[model samples]
Target: MAENYYQTLGVDRHASAEEIKKSYRKLARKYHPDVSKEADAEEKMQAINVAYDTLNNPEKKAEYDQMLDNPQGFAGFGQGAQGQGGFDGAHFYRQSTGGGEHADFSGFEDLFGRFGAGFGGSGSRRQQQSFQGEDQHAKIEVDLDVAYTGTTQQITLQIPTYNAHGEPEIQRKTLQVKIPKGMKEGQQIRLSGQGQAGINGGKAGDLYIEIQYKEDKRLYVEGADVYTTIDVSPWEAALGGQVEVNTPAGRLQINLPANAKNGQQLRLKGKGIPNSKEAGNLYLIINIVLPTAQNDQQKQAYQQLAQAFNAYNPRA
Candidate 1:
């Protein structure tokens, strides 16, 4: 039986494009074989990639949807698939017939031809070499401040140039990329015609850059919102006062209201890292800190104040 693509990716059929992509990226990073140590990591990664590719791409998603919705063309209803010994031959044949979607099958041809060279067909041998050179991959780390403010970066990528035998030899190149404001981690930026050179005059592939955030101690990002914990003295929490807070844009004065409690949040609108048109907000979490001790003079003053207000007992 064909695996349920939506279920494999843990997304609903009505999921938005952004949600689907976000889920896929998270799963892909977790299961990627190069970084993951699980025994089944590679298989899981491949399955995730396949399922994502099917559902995220509109054409493939439509095809799958149609097949499921109109299984009457074959010998099964939707539920009939499980009870009737899995997918029947008629269903398999219909799926293989492209389901009336015209996709370029040349990639499959090359894949098969390369593995079936023993057949000794001259056509197959040519097809085997028709695949473009391997696509190059690189990850770029950017500062969180830059992600909000948007900045261009000059990055160096070592692209592999292949010899006639397809062995990779690294060639270095520098590219200036405009990182859009409000860029998020795991988001991808593509440079057209910047990937591997195509085979036999075919168009060059594309360069894909995935975004990664450098660790920042002061800020935590969740989607568009930025969070930071601010330390406030007990008096500041008890009596509202204006305090200067640091943001990626710079320091700004924020008001801490009287009676503010720990974990209280103050929102600064349009102060987050700037994207293109609008900016996200910054959330300041209040952390109340108490002074442990004071000098002799300060302690004497505190003792006098305590005697004046002896009726107060916080514990009681």
Candidate 2:
């Protein structure tokens, strides 16, 4: 009998995407080969993965549902439909992509499940007309500095496939990617011919990778602009002078205006993300740091300073 994906994930056939993911994650925590002490954890994990791969994808899930609805509906559509080998539409779809040796899922990790805005793929799989393979999308996160300096990253994606013996399996495909400098958040990098294979010699679809910056306590990004906080001594805020500070690109000194107020902002032009077209600006937020007096001399100085501004009621 064909495996029931809904039963495999312990979900109702009508489970929503979130519900399915939640259930899959719950199972993953339990039967994940690395953590589970169950003797058959490996087999159970493979079965779990196979089930999730089908149910998580809307297109595959729909076809799988249809196959369940009508067991003999796809018999004439493909050679391995049901019965003979318990195959279904999804199985043929996997074959259409390409066959490969099963890869290890040692560190399988997928945060933003691969889906797309529907670029193009797997269309018109009729007998006469060829169809392009489906395009794939994945999101990756990098440090804020990568936008300034650029970097190379290797990513592994789980691809569903069938083995030579005609059993469903997941394949791990890793690729080295070059992240160009000045790339902004939500930007996409296209890898040609890296998606599923086309039917009847049609051109293969492309893989689009979206870029995301990891969160940083000191820095924040807004489009091409960058913002950061810099602490200034009380005197520096009151009596403007040049001070050196750090930045994503490097450190530099900036002149502060006399009587500069706390929480004031200074813009350093062309200091933000360096995209190929235009560079962004960097803004520094000033925070006044006060010094506490412990010695008599320091106390006397503070008293004198207070006397100089005796009539100045800050609140008033």
Candidate 3:
């Protein structure tokens, strides 16, 4: 008896057509003889292909279901459907025609053609069809400055390609990719037709480049917005004044609010990453820095200032 078709594909007997197709695609990628390194990969792939072919077709699936329901009646059916020998739909057709030598196989040709196209044929070679190349994914690191202002970057990738002998080989591909400004972390940049080469003259696949930022202690990125700490002298924080600060875009003089407290965040609109879309905002977090007295005059000034604010309790 043949292996249970559902069990062969690791699907339920009532698995939907879409579910069956998904399982087949996943298993095909895993156990394909050209890719798989397992000793029994070829045999396992043949079984997977046969299982998918039988269950994928409505008519064949119905026939298979009936056989499963009454195994005794179809005892002679699917004798070599398990391992090396694939499911024999042709033999089943022959048996249905009372084992006659003139049994017609033309009706089954189309059925087998679809299955044979997917998995390399067993008996006769079938006409090969064009297949789109698989898509590729990679990561590219850019500085915060590059993210703020769009720049072109040259990236090299080791792409999989098939040689004349149909053996898989890695080829180095260098691409000059333009990264748009305001591109956030985890954002993808697509390169058309730069992925794996197609099979039999089919269209090549796309390459997706995920953006990552290099570690910078001075800047923190959040989407299009950027944050940075601005160190302000204690006097600058206490008294309202204009101060010059360095930003990713450029240097700008910003007014410090009167009695500006530590950790206060000030937003500079349209001062973040510049892009065609809405520009990001830059946030400046305040950090008050106290100056240490280096001489008696400075110490006396600090003592007088401390005495002036003696009544104020920060912890309270």
Candidate 4:
């Protein structure tokens, strides 16, 4: 007995045409003899192709479903009429030969033409007319400064190129790409017609560039917002004064509140990445740095201050 087509394709009997096609494509890519290293890749691919060809066609699928529903009806379909089968040969013969509807054999021709080449028939096969190239993906690292201010970068890529003999070779290509401002990390920048070359006059695929921010010790990004930790002297946090700081936008002066506690965040509105849709805010996280009393005079001064604030216990 032949294997069930639905079981071969790993699909349910009632699976939709689209679902069957999706499964077939996925399996074909995995089992394609050109890329797959499995010893039985060609055999698996042939089975997948046969199953897809049968189930993808509406008429063939209907007939297949009927055979599955009543296996006894098709027991002698390929055998001669003299076989003593349970099904009435006269009725089966009438249904197979008397109908005006012709059996569609288009899929069988294609199946044999495509898979026969694998079985030592490549010399007689014709070339495919057109085929779309595979898509290519790559990651691009950009500094935060470059992301904040749009800049042009010259990038070198190892692109696949076809030679005069139609053989694939890796060629180094240089492109000057414009990095747009406010482009977030993990966002993709697509360059059309920059991927693999098409075959037989087909259009080339696209190249997708994923943006990644270089790690900065001072700055961290979340969406459009930027965050940085600013260190302030203990006296500066206690006295409340203006301090000059360097931000991604530029240099700016920020006022520290009196008695500001450590780990306090100050929001600088509209100072982050500038986007037409929505602008981000910059946050300054304050960290108080205590002075070390290395000298005798400094130690004495600290001792006096400790005595002055003895009543003010932090744990209280």
Candidate 5:
């Protein structure tokens, strides 16, 4: 099923032309193929474009409305009879059969040729002469913790303003963007009217911010869950007990089994990023490090313990 364009753009059904354009720009930047990591981002972008193409143009919007109002009524009269109350079958037939009402009118070929030359040419010319400002691009580095639990960032963008002939000038702008929850690396947040000033009086293009994640040494995030290594003493591995640990949320005490082996995974439920519908899990892998002999007393203590345990095997 075709998605609702207004819903995709997150606008109302009665949105004005400017509102439509603004919504489209915001969504386009969000889902643009080059920058988005969301699943089906391109499909979303295509739908947005289709909706903008249909709604931005008055003629297309009218035709689309006509079809919606009277689904089976108009066979080919792209212009429906809703607003044209006097229009009926006779008028349609007369117009189609070259009758008196349109006797002075030329055939479809000539009419279309003139229309093609006039409206199509002028539309293309107007598009060519459109006074769009240059698009601005920037990169923002957000922490992975922030990515996990969405955040708002105050970003400053420096974009080159352009003249009528597209010569570069200087401009700086700052925007407070609400980073959507669940936003991932390479995702974009578009700020409309935050780019270079428009040429003439046209609306400003946009500022696109590509997301980059800050590295976290303690925790490695993959989607919703987090992974980290926790160190334990040799004795702790032999006899498990509760240990203090640090997580993205905060420090907490968790159980570390006495028999915990190196590289063994211990899972903490609902301890990771919050954006996930279900709280993400935290995985801790055990890392055991041996204490080195530092003094004669320490070396003697280890030797006595080894003697009591009789556990030393150099090769083993």
Candidate 6:
């Protein structure tokens, strides 16, 4: 019996794409051949890869879901599979044809070729199943600037697929992918006919990639909004002043409000995640920095400021 990809990845059949990816990552790290001490680490890694390949693609997953939904296909007599003793065709073919030797079914072409090479008379495995290949999926991490400004990038992926003999193999592919501006995290960009190869003479499938942003030191994202920390001096927070701030969108001179407290967020509307409609906002979080009293003059200044605020209890 074929392995259930969901079980292989330790994910539920209805697991979301994100959940599937998370599980795959965990299992991959555990079974990584170089780091793992287990004897079956390499084999487990291979299975994880194959499972992720199937579950990551929407089309392929749907096909697999359909198969799983129909348990009769995996068990006894399904549709025309009925026999005197519920005999399986592939089993019978292998037995009667001398353990996979070619059998010429010239007149029974329609009968044998209906189920691909598993029951076909004599043809290359690829020539038997004339259907479009399963679509493939991959994820990419780019800098925040890449989301602001569109760019093209080269990407490589190990595409899992079946070859002419109906055996699984890895097809390494490198492609130049175009990234459009305003591409949000977890959004997908599609490339046509770049997935697994088509069976027989059928049309090939497409390749889709989920675009993500690499973590930035200062910037963080929530929904469409972007947030970044801005450092301001004690004076800048205490008194309204013009402060130069650097943001992912650009640099700007912001007017700091009087008595702006620490962790105060100043919103610059429509300045983040640019798009034609409903653009996101950029939020500047204020972080007040204290000046060091390094010398007598600075210490005296701090003393003076403390005296001026003697009536104010900061702890209060």
Best prediction by TM-score = 3
lDDT of 2 by residue, 141-259 (tens): 99888998989989898765333222346768899999999999999999998875544455766888999999888789999999988888878887898999988868889998888
The local distance difference test score of model 4 is 0.73
Model 5 score (lDDT): 0.64
lDDT of 6 by residue, 117-212 (tens): 333235546223255667889999998877778899998899987665445689999999999988889999989999877655667779999998
lDDT per residue (tens digit) for residues 1-316 in model 3: 5557788788898789988975675565556555566677767876776677668878778877876686566655445443233335556555444537776554355444654544445666544444456678999888878877789999898887654333568979999999987788899999999887765566878999999988778679887788988899988998969999987777889999989999999999988877677888999999898889999999999999989999988899
Q: Lowest summed-lDDT stretch of 10 residues in model 6?
A: 78-87
Segments of candidate 3 deviating more than 4 angstroms: 1-88, 91-108, 111-126, 158-172, 274-277, 295-297
- Tell me the number of clashing residue pairs for each predicted model: 4, 0, 0, 0, 3, 0
Give lDDT for model 1. 0.67
Residue pairs in clash, model 4: none
Which residue pairs in candidate 3 have backbone atoms (N, alpha carbon, C) closer than 3 angstroms, thus clashing?
A: none
What lDDT would each prediction earn against the true structure?
0.67, 0.72, 0.75, 0.73, 0.64, 0.72
The predicted structure with the larger TM-score, 4 or 6, is: 4
Order candidates by lDDT, high to low. 3, 4, 6, 2, 1, 5
Q: Cα deviation in Å at residue 289, candidate 6?
A: 1.3
Model 1: per-residue lDDT, tens digit, 17-116? 8888867755654554444556776567656655665676677678767656765554442343223533332233245446344534432343334434
Model 5: which residue pairs collide?
A: 239-258, 240-257, 240-258
Model 5 TM-score relative to the real fold: 0.53
Which is the winner by TM-score between candidate 1 and candidate 6?
6
Q: For residue 145, what is the lDDT in candidate 5?
A: 63
Candidate 1: worst 10 consecutive residues by lDDT? 124-133
